[model samples]
Target: MNLVQLKMLDAIVRTQSLSKAANALHKSQPALTLAIKKLEAELGFELLDRNQYRLSLTEKGKLFHREAAQLLSAQSYLTQLANELALGNEANFKICYEQLCHAPQYNDIICDAFRQYQSTEFSVSSGKRFASLEQVNTAQADLGIGPWFDLFHATGDLESMPIGKLDIGIVCANNLVPKRVKYKQLQDYPCLAMFESEMSFDSERLSYSKGSAIMKIDDIATLKSFLISGAGWAMISLAHCQSELDSGLLQRVEVLDREHTFSAQIRVFRQYSVHHGPVARAIWQGFKRASEQFIND
Candidate 1:
């Protein structure tokens, strides 16, 4: 079947009405109906079920919709690649993050690697975590560095390599702690939390639990600012706070009777075709070498 027909089918399934789908695709309702009729006749299956103003996909249609999305994505990638080739050597790269990259040590190492490989010649910018990943999967980014969540593994063709791992900890102001602190004690005091879209571990969803009025912040900069100012204790990456920890600017507040540590893996995932580029190849090699030495040290 033609790509247009498949796209129409996906749109109908997504929008759930023939008129809505037609409006979305910018096509007349009758034309869309004809396309859908021809597709169903050719495939010999009922693709959609309509009831009044609503439409629902049949089992076969649902299966086809999934495959259609991937096919469309691949086609879009090919079109972008052609456009990039027309633009000559001004390559582009995107970096996405769940939180702002304020960790001086990690940032320096990444920037050093980019300079070592002359990656600075290319374009780089930060975006929201999932949007950044979508750019990478769509041939928009050469590399992505961010925190790992369960949904990250579901990207079909993107290969992920966890370059290094760092543990997350609670960052408390110096005056707040003379020694180790207890997790139970946090219940008695105000705490700050950074909220991302989907909470990964429901049973262990600590922030949502009843405690001393949790303050929800959307960005890392504000979260860190509040913590350093002693607004409240915050959960943060140890690697990000290492220098602060050593300098007495920030101290680790041990909770849960033990360290509540989660490993943050700096992963690099790329499309096989994109890896063929000179800049992409150099950055890959540099990150690999640096990650090895980082873990060992």
Candidate 2:
């Protein structure tokens, strides 16, 4: 009926002897026997066979003992979790990142940094630049690391900070886009882009060249697949495609009037309402450190 009685029963099952069980409980053998009888009476079942030479639980007693062990385990976990939360660990921490946030790099650095918040349940995922912000703002994520956009404004209580920048460039396979380029000239060929919004589309035209033949692909890796197959030329993060560019598989295309290499700022975002405890703040600092070391160059 109580934790004490339950634990006593557990000891009895483990020891399998009334004398041993009593020794463990620091009580007399008769006292232990009486307690077991009372417990069985309360449960309306014969928990042990009095006639058996060896101490053993009846079928029902075995089930009750299993449930008791589970209850004790649950209590222990709950107590540990409560203590951990009181000590400033997040009960559940969700972090969604932009696909280009260099997950492997963070894994090397932040994994050890997160050890301090041992009780904090942590999870990580990757998505588009906007999806990262959206996840943090909607309370789906405690934090987000994404490629920053100058025009994308994160309103409400969400706080965003620029951790670093991603170096990117307009690239074509085998220098096929042409050496002498104009914004208008690119309009003649298919341009791969990530976002589909009219403003983003307009920004694309205005930033690089005017174009309606632009294709929208949300994923950068997939876009690279298309570009490899000679689908079209598109602006992409140089950090991601450096190996291909180094091996002469792809080449950067520059406009006649503008520089070819450009960069997008990378930012970390979190909601003000999310509990930024000492551990969470420490985690964020660790992220900043990793970002700084992962320079575009």
Q: Which number leads on TM-score? A: 1
lDDT values of the candidates?
0.65, 0.72
- Each candidate: RMSD to true structure? 5.4, 18.6
- Cα lDDT tens digits, model 2, 113-172, are 567667777788765446676677555787888777755563436666666777878887
**Could you tell me which 10 consecutive residues in candidate 2 have the lowest summed lDDT?**
196-205
lDDT of 1 at 244: 79
Looking at candidate 1, the ten consecutive residues that score lowest on lDDT are 196-205
What TM-score should be assigned to candidate 2? 0.59
Model 1, global lDDT: 0.65
Q: In candidate 2, residue 164 scores what lDDT? A: 70
